[model samples]
Target: MKIALVGIGKIAVDQHIPAINDSPDWELAATVSRHGSVDGVDAFTDLGDMLDARPDIRVVSLCLPPVPRFAYAMQALAAGRHVMLEKPPGATLAECHALTAKAQADGLSLYATWHSRQADMVAAAKEWLTDKRLTRLHVTWKEDVRRWHPGQDWIWEPGGLGVFDPGINALSIVTDILPHPIHVTGATLKVPENRQTPIAVNLEFHHPQGAQVTADFDWRQEGDQIWMIEAETEAGTLTLTDGGATLKINGERSGTAAPLGGEYPRLYAQMAQLIADGGIDMDLRPMTLVADAYTLGRRETVAPFHD
Candidate 1:
Protein backbone atom coordinates (compact mmCIF):
# COMPACT_ATOMS: atom_id res chain seq x y z
CA MET A 1 0.00 0.00 0.00
CA LYS A 2 1.20 3.51 -0.79
CA ILE A 3 1.09 6.18 1.92
CA ALA A 4 1.21 9.93 1.43
CA LEU A 5 2.86 11.44 4.50
CA VAL A 6 1.43 14.95 4.84
CA GLY A 7 3.79 16.31 7.46
CA ILE A 8 7.58 16.12 7.75
CA GLY A 9 8.08 17.51 11.23
CA LYS A 10 10.41 16.10 13.88
CA ILE A 11 8.13 13.19 14.75
CA ALA A 12 7.55 12.35 11.13
CA VAL A 13 11.26 12.20 10.47
CA ASP A 14 12.24 10.48 13.69
CA GLN A 15 9.44 7.94 14.04
CA HIS A 16 6.90 7.88 11.20
CA ILE A 17 9.44 7.61 8.40
CA PRO A 18 11.25 4.78 10.13
CA ALA A 19 7.96 3.02 10.79
CA ILE A 20 6.95 3.35 7.17
CA ASN A 21 10.27 1.96 6.08
CA ASP A 22 9.83 -1.06 8.35
CA SER A 23 6.19 -1.68 7.42
CA PRO A 24 5.63 -4.47 4.96
CA ASP A 25 2.05 -3.30 4.58
CA TRP A 26 2.78 0.30 3.59
CA GLU A 27 5.34 2.38 1.72
CA LEU A 28 6.33 6.03 1.70
CA ALA A 29 4.81 6.94 -1.65
CA ALA A 30 5.21 10.67 -1.20
CA THR A 31 5.48 13.53 1.27
CA VAL A 32 3.87 16.97 1.29
CA SER A 33 5.42 19.77 3.32
CA ARG A 34 6.07 23.44 2.90
CA HIS A 35 9.30 23.56 4.91
CA GLY A 36 10.52 19.96 5.39
CA SER A 37 11.12 17.05 3.06
CA VAL A 38 12.23 13.43 3.40
CA ASP A 39 15.27 12.16 1.56
CA GLY A 40 14.80 10.02 -1.58
CA VAL A 41 11.03 10.35 -1.50
CA ASP A 42 8.71 12.25 -3.84
CA ALA A 43 8.08 15.60 -2.12
CA PHE A 44 5.63 18.41 -2.87
CA THR A 45 4.94 21.79 -1.35
CA ASP A 46 1.16 21.45 -1.49
CA LEU A 47 -1.12 18.60 -0.46
CA GLY A 48 -3.47 18.94 -3.40
CA ASP A 49 -0.61 18.95 -5.84
CA MET A 50 0.90 15.90 -4.15
CA LEU A 51 -2.42 14.10 -4.30
CA ASP A 52 -2.73 14.96 -7.96
CA ALA A 53 0.77 13.79 -8.75
CA ARG A 54 0.62 10.56 -6.76
CA PRO A 55 -2.60 8.95 -7.90
CA ASP A 56 -1.37 5.64 -6.46
CA ILE A 57 -1.49 6.93 -2.89
CA ARG A 58 -4.11 4.94 -0.97
CA VAL A 59 -3.70 6.30 2.54
CA VAL A 60 -2.94 9.81 3.85
CA SER A 61 -0.98 9.86 7.09
CA LEU A 62 -1.43 13.28 8.66
CA CYS A 63 1.06 14.55 11.26
CA LEU A 64 0.01 18.15 11.00
CA PRO A 65 -0.84 20.27 14.04
CA PRO A 66 -4.20 19.53 15.64
CA VAL A 67 -5.64 22.88 14.52
CA PRO A 68 -5.22 21.98 10.83
CA ARG A 69 -5.50 18.19 11.11
CA PHE A 70 -9.27 18.13 10.70
CA ALA A 71 -9.27 20.23 7.52
CA TYR A 72 -6.55 18.11 5.93
CA ALA A 73 -8.26 14.87 6.91
CA MET A 74 -11.50 16.22 5.43
CA GLN A 75 -9.71 16.97 2.20
CA ALA A 76 -8.18 13.48 2.13
CA LEU A 77 -11.55 11.89 2.72
CA ALA A 78 -13.05 13.99 -0.04
CA ALA A 79 -10.33 12.75 -2.33
CA GLY A 80 -11.46 9.17 -1.63
CA ARG A 81 -8.52 8.06 0.50
CA HIS A 82 -8.05 6.42 3.88
CA VAL A 83 -6.60 8.50 6.73
CA MET A 84 -4.22 7.83 9.61
CA LEU A 85 -4.41 10.64 12.15
CA GLU A 86 -1.85 11.33 14.84
CA LYS A 87 -2.79 11.69 18.52
CA PRO A 88 -5.21 14.35 19.73
CA PRO A 89 -6.79 14.07 16.30
CA GLY A 90 -8.29 17.57 16.18
CA ALA A 91 -8.35 20.85 18.06
CA THR A 92 -11.85 20.06 19.31
CA LEU A 93 -13.78 16.89 20.05
CA ALA A 94 -16.70 17.71 17.75
CA GLU A 95 -14.46 17.98 14.70
CA CYS A 96 -12.81 14.61 15.36
CA HIS A 97 -16.13 12.86 15.90
CA ALA A 98 -17.52 14.47 12.76
CA LEU A 99 -14.48 13.32 10.82
CA THR A 100 -15.07 9.76 11.98
CA ALA A 101 -18.66 9.98 10.80
CA LYS A 102 -17.57 11.39 7.48
CA ALA A 103 -15.04 8.60 7.01
CA GLN A 104 -17.64 5.94 7.75
CA ALA A 105 -20.14 7.52 5.40
CA ASP A 106 -17.53 7.52 2.65
CA GLY A 107 -16.65 3.85 3.34
CA LEU A 108 -13.02 4.63 4.10
CA SER A 109 -10.87 3.76 7.07
CA LEU A 110 -10.01 6.54 9.51
CA TYR A 111 -7.60 5.49 12.25
CA ALA A 112 -7.28 7.83 15.23
CA THR A 113 -4.11 6.33 16.67
CA TRP A 114 -3.01 6.72 20.29
CA HIS A 115 0.66 5.91 19.90
CA SER A 116 1.37 5.55 23.61
CA ARG A 117 -1.21 2.80 23.79
CA GLN A 118 1.06 0.91 21.43
CA ALA A 119 3.76 0.69 24.12
CA ASP A 120 5.41 -2.69 24.63
CA MET A 121 3.83 -3.50 27.97
CA VAL A 122 0.54 -1.60 27.74
CA ALA A 123 -1.41 -4.67 26.71
CA ALA A 124 0.27 -6.71 29.42
CA ALA A 125 -0.69 -4.12 32.02
CA LYS A 126 -4.25 -4.14 30.80
CA GLU A 127 -4.34 -7.92 31.12
CA TRP A 128 -2.89 -7.79 34.62
CA LEU A 129 -5.53 -5.26 35.72
CA THR A 130 -8.40 -7.27 34.27
CA ASP A 131 -9.11 -9.55 37.23
CA LYS A 132 -7.52 -7.39 39.96
CA ARG A 133 -9.62 -5.09 42.06
CA LEU A 134 -8.30 -1.56 41.75
CA THR A 135 -7.83 0.67 44.80
CA ARG A 136 -6.05 3.80 43.56
CA LEU A 137 -4.57 5.23 40.37
CA HIS A 138 -1.88 7.90 40.09
CA VAL A 139 -0.10 9.52 37.14
CA THR A 140 2.89 11.86 37.25
CA TRP A 141 4.11 13.29 33.95
CA LYS A 142 6.72 16.08 34.00
CA GLU A 143 9.32 17.25 31.50
CA ASP A 144 11.02 20.41 30.35
CA VAL A 145 9.48 21.95 27.23
CA ARG A 146 12.78 23.54 26.25
CA ARG A 147 14.43 20.13 25.99
CA TRP A 148 11.58 18.44 24.15
CA HIS A 149 9.70 21.07 22.16
CA PRO A 150 12.15 23.86 21.45
CA GLY A 151 10.98 26.82 19.36
CA GLN A 152 7.43 25.47 19.16
CA ASP A 153 5.45 28.62 19.93
CA TRP A 154 2.16 26.98 19.02
CA ILE A 155 2.35 24.91 22.23
CA TRP A 156 1.86 28.05 24.34
CA GLU A 157 -1.07 29.10 22.17
CA PRO A 158 -4.67 28.30 23.03
CA GLY A 159 -5.14 25.23 20.85
CA GLY A 160 -1.66 23.84 21.37
CA LEU A 161 -2.52 22.15 24.72
CA GLY A 162 0.82 22.99 26.49
CA VAL A 163 1.45 20.48 29.28
CA PHE A 164 -1.69 18.59 28.34
CA ASP A 165 -0.04 17.64 25.08
CA PRO A 166 2.33 15.27 26.89
CA GLY A 167 -0.32 14.75 29.53
CA ILE A 168 -2.65 13.33 26.89
CA ASN A 169 -0.10 10.70 25.94
CA ALA A 170 -0.13 9.54 29.56
CA LEU A 171 -3.93 9.75 29.51
CA SER A 172 -4.03 7.51 26.46
CA ILE A 173 -1.89 4.92 28.19
CA VAL A 174 -3.98 5.00 31.39
CA THR A 175 -7.23 4.82 29.49
CA ASP A 176 -6.03 1.80 27.58
CA ILE A 177 -4.43 -0.06 30.46
CA LEU A 178 -7.28 0.24 32.90
CA PRO A 179 -9.93 -2.46 32.94
CA HIS A 180 -12.70 0.17 32.92
CA PRO A 181 -13.15 3.75 31.83
CA ILE A 182 -12.28 6.70 34.08
CA HIS A 183 -13.99 10.09 34.34
CA VAL A 184 -12.79 13.43 35.58
CA THR A 185 -14.20 14.62 38.90
CA GLY A 186 -12.31 17.91 39.22
CA ALA A 187 -9.13 19.63 38.07
CA THR A 188 -6.69 22.47 38.76
CA LEU A 189 -4.86 24.12 35.86
CA LYS A 190 -1.85 26.42 36.28
CA VAL A 191 -1.24 28.81 33.44
CA PRO A 192 1.69 31.09 32.79
CA GLU A 193 1.03 34.82 32.82
CA ASN A 194 2.19 35.22 29.23
CA ARG A 195 0.75 32.04 27.72
CA GLN A 196 -2.80 31.16 26.80
CA THR A 197 -2.58 27.49 27.82
CA PRO A 198 -1.74 25.96 31.17
CA ILE A 199 1.84 25.14 32.09
CA ALA A 200 0.68 22.51 34.57
CA VAL A 201 -2.49 20.69 35.59
CA ASN A 202 -3.75 18.36 38.30
CA LEU A 203 -6.81 16.29 37.47
CA GLU A 204 -8.92 14.16 39.77
CA PHE A 205 -10.75 11.23 38.25
CA HIS A 206 -12.71 8.19 39.33
CA HIS A 207 -13.80 4.91 37.85
CA PRO A 208 -17.30 3.53 38.19
CA GLN A 209 -15.75 0.55 40.00
CA GLY A 210 -14.58 2.82 42.88
CA ALA A 211 -10.97 3.48 41.92
CA GLN A 212 -9.71 6.99 42.74
CA VAL A 213 -7.49 8.50 40.06
CA THR A 214 -5.28 11.58 40.19
CA ALA A 215 -2.96 12.92 37.49
CA ASP A 216 -0.27 15.59 37.84
CA PHE A 217 1.15 17.28 34.78
CA ASP A 218 4.08 19.66 35.04
CA TRP A 219 6.18 21.12 32.23
CA ARG A 220 8.54 23.09 34.55
CA GLN A 221 10.82 20.22 35.57
CA GLU A 222 14.50 21.06 35.20
CA GLY A 223 16.19 17.65 35.35
CA ASP A 224 15.47 13.94 35.83
CA GLN A 225 12.08 14.21 34.20
CA ILE A 226 9.41 11.75 35.22
CA TRP A 227 6.73 9.77 33.39
CA MET A 228 5.27 7.23 35.72
CA ILE A 229 1.93 5.74 36.78
CA GLU A 230 0.96 3.55 39.72
CA ALA A 231 -2.03 1.28 40.21
CA GLU A 232 -2.76 -0.22 43.59
CA THR A 233 -5.09 -3.18 43.65
CA GLU A 234 -6.29 -5.40 46.45
CA ALA A 235 -3.86 -8.13 45.43
CA GLY A 236 -0.69 -6.26 44.45
CA THR A 237 0.67 -2.97 43.13
CA LEU A 238 1.52 -2.31 39.48
CA THR A 239 3.80 0.42 38.26
CA LEU A 240 4.32 1.60 34.69
CA THR A 241 7.28 3.90 34.19
CA ASP A 242 8.97 5.61 31.22
CA GLY A 243 5.53 6.52 29.89
CA GLY A 244 4.16 2.96 29.91
CA ALA A 245 7.19 1.52 28.21
CA THR A 246 8.25 -0.37 31.34
CA LEU A 247 6.19 -2.45 33.75
CA LYS A 248 6.74 -3.49 37.39
CA ILE A 249 4.56 -5.47 39.70
CA ASN A 250 5.15 -4.93 43.43
CA GLY A 251 8.59 -3.43 42.78
CA GLU A 252 9.59 -6.56 40.85
CA ARG A 253 10.22 -6.06 37.14
CA SER A 254 7.72 -7.78 34.92
CA GLY A 255 8.00 -8.84 31.31
CA THR A 256 8.06 -6.75 28.15
CA ALA A 257 9.00 -3.30 29.41
CA ALA A 258 10.57 -2.52 26.03
CA PRO A 259 9.10 -4.85 23.50
CA LEU A 260 11.25 -6.30 20.79
CA GLY A 261 8.74 -4.64 18.49
CA GLY A 262 8.91 -0.85 18.31
CA GLU A 263 5.83 1.18 19.17
CA TYR A 264 5.44 2.88 15.78
CA PRO A 265 5.94 -0.40 13.95
CA ARG A 266 3.16 -1.94 16.01
CA LEU A 267 1.05 1.18 15.42
CA TYR A 268 1.40 0.76 11.65
CA ALA A 269 0.45 -2.89 12.01
CA GLN A 270 -2.65 -1.73 13.89
CA MET A 271 -3.47 0.68 11.06
CA ALA A 272 -3.11 -2.14 8.56
CA GLN A 273 -5.50 -4.28 10.59
CA LEU A 274 -8.00 -1.44 10.79
CA ILE A 275 -7.79 -1.02 7.05
CA ALA A 276 -8.20 -4.72 6.44
CA ASP A 277 -11.04 -5.03 8.93
CA GLY A 278 -12.86 -2.24 7.14
CA GLY A 279 -13.76 0.06 10.04
CA ILE A 280 -12.75 3.14 12.00
CA ASP A 281 -11.26 3.29 15.52
CA MET A 282 -11.96 6.81 16.71
CA ASP A 283 -12.22 6.68 20.48
CA LEU A 284 -12.94 10.06 22.00
CA ARG A 285 -13.30 8.69 25.53
CA PRO A 286 -9.93 10.05 26.68
CA MET A 287 -10.39 13.32 24.84
CA THR A 288 -13.79 13.62 26.48
CA LEU A 289 -12.01 13.49 29.84
CA VAL A 290 -9.70 16.26 28.65
CA ALA A 291 -12.69 18.37 27.65
CA ASP A 292 -14.36 17.77 31.00
CA ALA A 293 -11.20 18.79 32.82
CA TYR A 294 -11.07 22.04 30.89
CA THR A 295 -14.73 22.66 31.60
CA LEU A 296 -14.52 22.03 35.36
CA GLY A 297 -10.93 23.01 36.08
CA ARG A 298 -10.08 26.00 38.26
CA ARG A 299 -7.45 28.20 36.66
CA GLU A 300 -4.54 29.71 38.58
CA THR A 301 -2.16 32.29 37.16
CA VAL A 302 1.49 31.40 37.68
CA ALA A 303 4.91 32.87 36.89
CA PRO A 304 5.30 33.61 33.18
CA PHE A 305 7.06 30.74 31.43
CA HIS A 306 9.86 31.55 29.01
CA ASP A 307 11.16 29.30 26.18
Candidate 2:
Protein backbone atom coordinates (compact mmCIF):
# COMPACT_ATOMS: atom_id res chain seq x y z
CA MET A 1 0.00 0.00 0.00
CA LYS A 2 1.27 3.42 -0.96
CA ILE A 3 1.13 5.80 2.00
CA ALA A 4 1.79 9.48 2.61
CA LEU A 5 2.89 10.84 5.98
CA VAL A 6 1.52 14.19 7.02
CA GLY A 7 3.46 16.34 9.50
CA ILE A 8 7.07 15.25 9.77
CA GLY A 9 7.37 16.25 13.40
CA LYS A 10 9.36 14.53 16.14
CA ILE A 11 6.98 11.57 16.35
CA ALA A 12 7.00 11.14 12.57
CA VAL A 13 10.78 11.04 12.52
CA ASP A 14 11.27 8.82 15.56
CA GLN A 15 8.48 6.21 15.30
CA HIS A 16 6.45 6.50 12.10
CA ILE A 17 9.43 6.62 9.70
CA PRO A 18 11.10 3.56 11.21
CA ALA A 19 7.81 1.68 11.37
CA ILE A 20 7.06 2.43 7.71
CA ASN A 21 10.51 1.18 6.73
CA ASP A 22 10.00 -2.11 8.56
CA SER A 23 6.57 -2.89 7.12
CA PRO A 24 6.52 -4.88 3.86
CA ASP A 25 2.90 -4.05 3.13
CA TRP A 26 3.46 -0.30 3.29
CA GLU A 27 5.66 2.03 1.24
CA LEU A 28 6.34 5.61 2.25
CA ALA A 29 5.28 7.43 -0.92
CA ALA A 30 5.38 11.05 0.17
CA THR A 31 5.64 13.41 3.14
CA VAL A 32 4.24 16.81 4.12
CA SER A 33 5.91 19.14 6.59
CA ARG A 34 6.47 22.82 6.95
CA HIS A 35 10.20 22.36 7.67
CA GLY A 36 11.17 18.72 7.68
CA SER A 37 12.30 16.18 5.08
CA VAL A 38 12.68 12.46 4.64
CA ASP A 39 15.37 10.89 2.49
CA GLY A 40 14.33 9.20 -0.80
CA VAL A 41 10.73 10.42 -0.48
CA ASP A 42 8.94 13.27 -2.21
CA ALA A 43 8.63 16.08 0.35
CA PHE A 44 6.22 19.03 0.22
CA THR A 45 5.49 21.74 2.72
CA ASP A 46 1.74 21.39 2.27
CA LEU A 47 -0.44 18.28 2.52
CA GLY A 48 -2.65 19.36 -0.37
CA ASP A 49 0.33 19.57 -2.73
CA MET A 50 1.48 16.10 -1.78
CA LEU A 51 -2.03 14.67 -2.12
CA ASP A 52 -2.53 16.32 -5.50
CA ALA A 53 0.79 14.97 -6.74
CA ARG A 54 0.16 11.40 -5.56
CA PRO A 55 -3.48 10.56 -6.05
CA ASP A 56 -2.63 6.86 -5.98
CA ILE A 57 -1.65 7.09 -2.32
CA ARG A 58 -4.03 4.62 -0.73
CA VAL A 59 -3.37 5.66 2.87
CA VAL A 60 -2.41 8.82 4.75
CA SER A 61 -0.97 8.85 8.25
CA LEU A 62 -1.60 12.11 10.08
CA CYS A 63 1.17 12.85 12.56
CA LEU A 64 0.14 16.39 13.22
CA PRO A 65 -0.93 17.63 16.65
CA PRO A 66 -4.47 16.95 17.81
CA VAL A 67 -5.67 20.46 16.97
CA PRO A 68 -5.08 20.11 13.22
CA ARG A 69 -5.53 16.37 12.73
CA PHE A 70 -9.27 16.52 12.17
CA ALA A 71 -8.99 18.69 9.08
CA TYR A 72 -6.21 16.61 7.64
CA ALA A 73 -8.14 13.40 8.16
CA MET A 74 -11.23 14.90 6.60
CA GLN A 75 -9.27 15.95 3.54
CA ALA A 76 -7.67 12.55 3.14
CA LEU A 77 -10.92 10.63 3.64
CA ALA A 78 -12.69 12.87 1.14
CA ALA A 79 -10.00 11.91 -1.34
CA GLY A 80 -10.85 8.24 -0.76
CA ARG A 81 -7.62 7.35 1.10
CA HIS A 82 -7.61 5.57 4.41
CA VAL A 83 -6.39 7.74 7.32
CA MET A 84 -4.55 6.86 10.49
CA LEU A 85 -4.56 9.33 13.37
CA GLU A 86 -2.05 9.62 16.14
CA LYS A 87 -3.10 9.49 19.82
CA PRO A 88 -5.95 11.49 21.33
CA PRO A 89 -7.69 11.39 17.91
CA GLY A 90 -8.63 15.08 17.81
CA ALA A 91 -8.77 18.18 20.01
CA THR A 92 -12.49 17.90 20.65
CA LEU A 93 -15.05 15.11 20.92
CA ALA A 94 -17.24 16.76 18.29
CA GLU A 95 -14.43 16.75 15.74
CA CYS A 96 -13.76 13.08 16.31
CA HIS A 97 -17.44 12.26 15.80
CA ALA A 98 -17.44 14.21 12.54
CA LEU A 99 -14.37 12.44 11.27
CA THR A 100 -15.97 9.10 12.03
CA ALA A 101 -19.04 10.02 10.05
CA LYS A 102 -17.01 11.31 7.11
CA ALA A 103 -14.96 8.13 6.94
CA GLN A 104 -18.11 6.01 7.01
CA ALA A 105 -19.75 8.09 4.32
CA ASP A 106 -16.66 7.79 2.16
CA GLY A 107 -16.24 4.08 2.88
CA LEU A 108 -12.62 4.53 4.02
CA SER A 109 -10.88 3.17 7.03
CA LEU A 110 -10.03 5.51 9.91
CA TYR A 111 -7.67 4.29 12.60
CA ALA A 112 -7.14 6.28 15.80
CA THR A 113 -4.10 4.72 17.42
CA TRP A 114 -3.21 4.96 21.09
CA HIS A 115 0.46 4.02 21.13
CA SER A 116 0.45 3.15 24.83
CA ARG A 117 -2.18 0.50 24.17
CA GLN A 118 0.40 -1.28 22.03
CA ALA A 119 2.76 -1.66 24.98
CA ASP A 120 4.12 -5.17 25.50
CA MET A 121 2.46 -5.73 28.87
CA VAL A 122 -1.00 -4.51 27.88
CA ALA A 123 -2.21 -7.92 26.75
CA ALA A 124 -0.99 -9.59 29.92
CA ALA A 125 -2.68 -6.97 32.07
CA LYS A 126 -5.93 -7.56 30.22
CA GLU A 127 -5.61 -11.31 30.64
CA TRP A 128 -5.03 -10.97 34.37
CA LEU A 129 -8.04 -8.71 34.82
CA THR A 130 -10.45 -11.04 33.08
CA ASP A 131 -13.52 -11.91 35.24
CA LYS A 132 -11.93 -10.13 38.21
CA ARG A 133 -13.63 -7.48 40.25
CA LEU A 134 -11.43 -4.46 40.59
CA THR A 135 -11.74 -2.45 43.80
CA ARG A 136 -9.48 0.53 43.17
CA LEU A 137 -6.91 1.87 40.68
CA HIS A 138 -4.15 4.41 41.24
CA VAL A 139 -2.02 5.95 38.50
CA THR A 140 0.92 8.27 39.01
CA TRP A 141 2.68 9.76 35.99
CA LYS A 142 5.15 12.49 36.84
CA GLU A 143 7.83 13.58 34.36
CA ASP A 144 10.11 16.47 33.50
CA VAL A 145 8.51 18.04 30.49
CA ARG A 146 11.55 20.17 29.68
CA ARG A 147 13.63 17.06 29.20
CA TRP A 148 11.02 15.33 27.05
CA HIS A 149 9.35 18.13 25.12
CA PRO A 150 12.16 20.69 25.07
CA GLY A 151 10.83 23.78 23.31
CA GLN A 152 7.53 22.44 22.04
CA ASP A 153 5.31 25.44 22.77
CA TRP A 154 2.11 23.88 21.54
CA ILE A 155 1.95 21.64 24.61
CA TRP A 156 1.04 24.65 26.72
CA GLU A 157 -1.54 26.07 24.36
CA PRO A 158 -5.30 25.79 24.62
CA GLY A 159 -5.71 22.52 22.75
CA GLY A 160 -2.20 21.13 23.26
CA LEU A 161 -3.25 18.83 26.17
CA GLY A 162 -0.57 19.91 28.68
CA VAL A 163 -0.71 17.29 31.47
CA PHE A 164 -3.25 15.15 29.60
CA ASP A 165 -0.46 14.35 27.16
CA PRO A 166 0.70 11.65 29.55
CA GLY A 167 -2.54 11.28 31.46
CA ILE A 168 -4.15 9.97 28.27
CA ASN A 169 -1.78 7.01 28.31
CA ALA A 170 -3.07 6.02 31.71
CA LEU A 171 -6.62 6.36 30.45
CA SER A 172 -5.84 4.17 27.45
CA ILE A 173 -4.54 1.39 29.66
CA VAL A 174 -7.48 1.71 32.04
CA THR A 175 -9.96 1.50 29.21
CA ASP A 176 -8.21 -1.51 27.74
CA ILE A 177 -7.93 -3.58 30.93
CA LEU A 178 -11.08 -2.62 32.77
CA PRO A 179 -14.07 -4.97 32.53
CA HIS A 180 -16.53 -2.12 31.96
CA PRO A 181 -16.61 1.41 30.70
CA ILE A 182 -15.70 4.34 33.00
CA HIS A 183 -16.64 7.97 33.21
CA VAL A 184 -14.82 10.85 34.81
CA THR A 185 -16.72 11.83 37.94
CA GLY A 186 -14.51 14.65 39.14
CA ALA A 187 -11.32 16.45 38.09
CA THR A 188 -9.01 19.16 39.43
CA LEU A 189 -6.71 20.87 36.96
CA LYS A 190 -3.70 22.91 38.10
CA VAL A 191 -2.96 25.45 35.42
CA PRO A 192 0.34 27.27 35.40
CA GLU A 193 0.05 30.91 36.21
CA ASN A 194 1.27 31.86 32.77
CA ARG A 195 -0.50 29.26 30.68
CA GLN A 196 -4.05 28.73 29.61
CA THR A 197 -4.01 24.94 30.11
CA PRO A 198 -3.29 22.75 33.05
CA ILE A 199 0.17 21.44 33.92
CA ALA A 200 -1.13 18.98 36.47
CA VAL A 201 -4.42 17.20 37.02
CA ASN A 202 -5.97 14.94 39.63
CA LEU A 203 -8.86 12.98 38.21
CA GLU A 204 -11.41 10.61 39.74
CA PHE A 205 -13.27 8.04 37.66
CA HIS A 206 -16.21 5.77 38.35
CA HIS A 207 -17.21 2.50 36.72
CA PRO A 208 -20.71 1.08 36.76
CA GLN A 209 -19.60 -1.70 39.11
CA GLY A 210 -18.44 0.82 41.76
CA ALA A 211 -14.80 0.49 40.76
CA GLN A 212 -12.87 3.64 41.57
CA VAL A 213 -9.88 4.98 39.67
CA THR A 214 -7.73 7.95 40.50
CA ALA A 215 -4.91 9.52 38.47
CA ASP A 216 -2.27 12.13 39.23
CA PHE A 217 -0.30 13.76 36.42
CA ASP A 218 2.25 16.50 36.88
CA TRP A 219 4.81 18.14 34.56
CA ARG A 220 6.92 19.80 37.22
CA GLN A 221 8.54 16.75 38.75
CA GLU A 222 12.31 16.52 38.51
CA GLY A 223 14.63 13.53 38.13
CA ASP A 224 13.54 9.89 38.44
CA GLN A 225 10.30 9.82 36.50
CA ILE A 226 7.41 7.68 37.62
CA TRP A 227 4.89 5.86 35.40
CA MET A 228 2.97 3.27 37.27
CA ILE A 229 -0.50 1.84 37.72
CA GLU A 230 -1.72 -0.31 40.59
CA ALA A 231 -5.05 -2.06 40.87
CA GLU A 232 -6.47 -3.82 43.91
CA THR A 233 -9.05 -6.43 43.17
CA GLU A 234 -10.79 -9.33 44.87
CA ALA A 235 -8.35 -11.77 43.31
CA GLY A 236 -5.25 -9.82 44.38
CA THR A 237 -3.24 -6.68 43.81
CA LEU A 238 -1.91 -6.06 40.30
CA THR A 239 0.85 -3.60 39.60
CA LEU A 240 2.09 -2.50 36.18
CA THR A 241 5.40 -0.71 36.32
CA ASP A 242 7.47 1.25 33.83
CA GLY A 243 4.38 2.30 31.94
CA GLY A 244 2.96 -1.19 31.60
CA ALA A 245 6.20 -2.95 30.70
CA THR A 246 6.47 -5.01 33.89
CA LEU A 247 3.48 -6.74 35.45
CA LYS A 248 3.15 -8.20 38.91
CA ILE A 249 0.31 -9.75 40.88
CA ASN A 250 0.35 -9.87 44.68
CA GLY A 251 4.07 -8.91 44.62
CA GLU A 252 4.99 -11.72 42.19
CA ARG A 253 6.06 -10.84 38.66
CA SER A 254 3.65 -12.42 36.20
CA GLY A 255 5.17 -11.37 32.87
CA THR A 256 8.39 -10.21 31.24
CA ALA A 257 8.75 -7.12 29.13
CA ALA A 258 8.52 -7.79 25.42
CA PRO A 259 10.18 -5.81 22.67
CA LEU A 260 8.61 -2.41 22.22
CA GLY A 261 7.77 -2.20 18.55
CA GLY A 262 6.74 0.92 16.71
CA GLU A 263 3.11 1.71 17.51
CA TYR A 264 2.57 3.25 14.08
CA PRO A 265 3.49 -0.02 12.37
CA ARG A 266 0.93 -1.93 14.36
CA LEU A 267 -1.57 0.82 13.68
CA TYR A 268 -0.91 0.70 9.98
CA ALA A 269 -1.27 -3.07 9.97
CA GLN A 270 -4.65 -2.71 11.69
CA MET A 271 -5.64 -0.11 9.13
CA ALA A 272 -4.74 -2.48 6.32
CA GLN A 273 -6.85 -5.22 7.89
CA LEU A 274 -9.77 -2.84 8.26
CA ILE A 275 -9.55 -1.82 4.63
CA ALA A 276 -9.33 -5.40 3.48
CA ASP A 277 -12.32 -6.47 5.54
CA GLY A 278 -14.35 -3.34 4.89
CA GLY A 279 -14.56 -2.41 8.59
CA ILE A 280 -13.60 0.38 10.97
CA ASP A 281 -11.84 0.09 14.33
CA MET A 282 -11.48 3.67 15.44
CA ASP A 283 -12.43 3.81 19.14
CA LEU A 284 -12.98 7.29 20.52
CA ARG A 285 -14.08 6.24 23.97
CA PRO A 286 -10.89 7.41 25.60
CA MET A 287 -10.97 10.72 23.82
CA THR A 288 -14.56 11.24 24.73
CA LEU A 289 -13.85 10.76 28.42
CA VAL A 290 -11.01 13.22 28.19
CA ALA A 291 -13.26 15.85 26.63
CA ASP A 292 -15.85 15.26 29.29
CA ALA A 293 -13.20 15.69 31.95
CA TYR A 294 -12.15 19.00 30.47
CA THR A 295 -15.70 20.25 30.18
CA LEU A 296 -16.62 19.44 33.77
CA GLY A 297 -13.31 19.72 35.58
CA ARG A 298 -12.62 22.66 37.84
CA ARG A 299 -9.58 24.83 37.17
CA GLU A 300 -7.09 26.11 39.71
CA THR A 301 -4.14 28.47 39.16
CA VAL A 302 -0.68 27.27 40.01
CA ALA A 303 2.80 28.77 39.99
CA PRO A 304 4.32 29.85 36.70
CA PHE A 305 6.37 27.28 34.81
CA HIS A 306 9.74 27.99 33.20
CA ASP A 307 11.84 25.90 30.87
Candidate 1 structure quality by residue, lDDT tens digits, 1-307 = 9999988998898889999998899989899999998888999988888777788998999998888888899989988899999888889999998998899899999988888888887888999999999999999999999998888888888779889889999999888888788889999999999999999999999788888889999999998989999999999999998878889999998985675248889878888988899989998777888889999999999999888
The alpha-carbon lDDT assigned to residue 227 of candidate 2 equals 84
lDDT per residue as tens, model 2, 1-307: 8989898988888899999889988899899898888999988888788778898898999989889888888988888888888888898888988988998888888888888887778788998898899899999989888987888888899889998988888888889988788898999999999997889999998878887788899988898988899999999999987777778999999867866564567776777888888787778777777787898899999999887
Model 2 lDDT on a 0 to 1 scale: 0.86
Q: Give the TM-score of candidate 2.
A: 0.97
Q: Model 2 Cα RMSD, Å?
A: 1.2
Q: Cα lDDT of all candidates, in order?
A: 0.89, 0.86
* Per-model TM-score on C-alpha atoms: 0.97, 0.97
Model 1 lDDT vs. the true structure?
Answer: 0.89
Model 1 ranges off by over 4 Å: 259-261
